[model samples]
Target: MLQTDSMWRCVCALVLTFPAYSTAVSGVLNSPTNVQLTSTNMDLVLKWDPPAGAPRDLVYTTELILRKPLMDSKPGCVNTSALQCDLTHLVVSIYGRYTGRVKAQLGAQSSAWASSDDFLLDKQTSIGPPNVSLYSNGAKLEVSITDPVFVHSSLREIYYYATYNITYWKKDRMKELKHISGLQQNRVVLHSLDPSTEYCVQVQIIASTAQKPSTPSIVHCARTPSEKEPPWVAVVVALFILAGVLTLVVFVVRHWRSLSHFLCPKYAIPEHFKESLLAPPKSSLYLVMQTSQPVEEFSDQISVVMCSRTEEDGSKKPAEEKR
Candidate 1:
């Protein structure tokens, strides 16, 4: 019975000592190790490794402490089983200094917090692509870019400044790439392009040396206007046409008389008919008068015969002829 009593006292003492030992063990848990901070275009992520001898089912919680010019904010991740936490939805300042820390928890016990080195938000975050606009100049293409405006409440700057990497190519000839880099201005002019040709352009944002460039903007397509004909060319063509028309008019005027005669001739008697009808009658009369009688007797006979013929035809002779 005495041995049993001693065993009971010893058991109670051991039980009391066990609680203190457990408490001490829980307090000495090693902190998480190798904490890291990384970022995407829109969000920040915190990652850490569990300490040695950490339980397989150990859960992690994280917190972000931000220090800005005039403000301080604390955003936390609670009761998460993941080794990494995404603090994207937090309303932390974009232009602020940030530090992320993580702690591992197993049931009621928790490890010490592992903190990351101080980092600037903009230094770790990438800028988004800029908006692009295209215009059709006569023989050139005009490209205008609008830089991204950060809308975080903590960001007081009006605009985010960035350099641009502009890439353009002809739609039909995509193998040939044209690039313009380190351009600080928002607008650029592309020259020596074929008139009325299809072209495509894209732009990317380069914010700082630490941050990588953002994704390229959506491709913009535009066609340059067609070329205009020169005034001198039109004038020369008009002069040639006018000269040709005038030459044709002068040729027609010079040949008009010959053309008319060929088309229509006047009606008249032939020279051969006049000679055959009049010459024979005159020759026969002359021969008859010479062979028949003397000139005076022939003339008197011709007059008496003409008078007899005139009376027989019911015509009267003049008084001078009768005498």
Candidate 2:
């Protein structure tokens, strides 16, 4: 009975080891599915779905293949556990066509690469929103655009060939849409705008004919400056008026007595009194008288009187005489 138990145990061990050995020799990893290529402003990205029933520890490898206008470059990613790869570091021409592939890999076994649909770099790639800056220059608005920089060296060349699409309008009037396209320069001047008016501006990137335009940038606003009055001009006018008022006040204070006397004098003569003093006398008269005292004591006392009158004809006559 002990010998029978030992044989049974050996058979159980073989059965267990056989299955593990066969799995290592015969098992092949499955290919990744749904491989796709997409682009952002900064880089091109390759993505794939893991194979169904793949092991929890399965890793992936990715490679980029140039299809048109062929070149000798093959850029690849290796031993990555993630589902996505960034191929922006590869320096391929913007006009060239590209395709990508990915595969599932175990320790010693790897599946066939699942290829992605072909795409052109310029046609499929996208660029980030441009940096917008605005300034008010009198009645005009100055707009400036700046392109975004990528982490990959190969993607920087897109900025050189990129053109811009700009749109601007008054803030209150949304129906009036003004668009400017194919602008190579970073700065543009908007003219014939009302002073102190609010305006909104937006910008997008158009890399080439093959590429779609980038998403529009955030709206930015700026106001044109209002006209200003000169400070010196107002000050000068006020000073002139003040000087005139002060001069008038000084003249009145100094000559107040003279002005009053000229209006009403202190001494004056009446006309009727002056006429009486100038008229001549109409007549004149004269008179004389005499008296005796010592002779009248021995005899009788005697008294005598005389008078004369002058007329307007200058004749004089004695009216009465006594002896």
Candidate 3:
């Protein structure tokens, strides 16, 4: 067992380091390793790892094998230095089986052809989600889908005909989702939607006669426009606003004096009115007026009487005695 293992390791090393020289015993160089043929939406690609000891500058040639007709990797993939080749045009039908063979060549020497495993397009091909765009029209939403771009071939060349499965729902009512299937048109309109509502939609492509459908597109959301307003409603609102502003301007020009009186009054506050808001009540004041009492009257106590005569001693005698 150890001897077998050592021999295998030596063979691997030789293949990795060997140039494109055919061996004397086999008359052929080592073949490529890990050859694989893959399909992306029916776009065929052939890839492989170089021989273990293969040198650089060794060109490769690839061939496509079908049931009856054999095809060469086109677009000058022959003698190509690239490790991969595009054989998309060689795929005639999705239901057909395909295989790829590649050989390394350097001048007069060549390697044994390395063949890939059988490839079934319908079973092995990978499909991608469609591109989605949304347009809003009041109470309706319009969806537009674009097919995913393939590496070599177009979507129509493979599928011939395709349909879409659209799923949508109101953002608020997520549990109540709706689906529309088998829609043939690339552009579709969803009507009867609630006005001014946000709705989300996702779409998936179903290739005709294909067993698998493309992945669902990313979620897209758009809000519908509000319900249509009467054409004259805006005009009426504008006229009313204009009239109110004009009326205000006219009133300001006419009664500006009255407004100024309140805005900048000329009258001073009376002493009573100047009292503090925090002052005590009238009964708590130093002097309180009684509404029921009559006002008191006062007179001069001294009377001035004309002197009838003067006393000889120059003293003003009593006017009554003189009289």
**Most TM-score-accurate candidate:** 2
Ranking by lDDT: 3, 2, 1
Best-to-worst order by TM-score is 2, 3, 1
Q: Which tens-of-lDDT digit does each residue in 182-277 have in candidate 2? A: 898999998878778899999987765535777788899999888556799999999999999999989878988997788877976677777876
Quote model 2's TM-score.
0.55
Clashes of each: 0, 1, 5
Error of 2 at 243 (Å): 8.8
* Superior by lDDT: candidate 1 or candidate 3: 3
Backbone clashes counted, model 1: 0
71-116, model 3: which lDDT tens digit per residue?
4343326899999999887666666678888998877778888989
List candidate 3 stretches off by more than 4 Å: 1-29, 68-76, 89-96, 106-109, 120-131, 146-161, 169-178, 191-200, 215-220, 226-323
lDDT of prediction 2: 0.79
Task: Give each model a TM-score.
Answer: 0.49, 0.55, 0.50
TM-score of candidate 1 on Cα atoms, chains taken together: 0.49
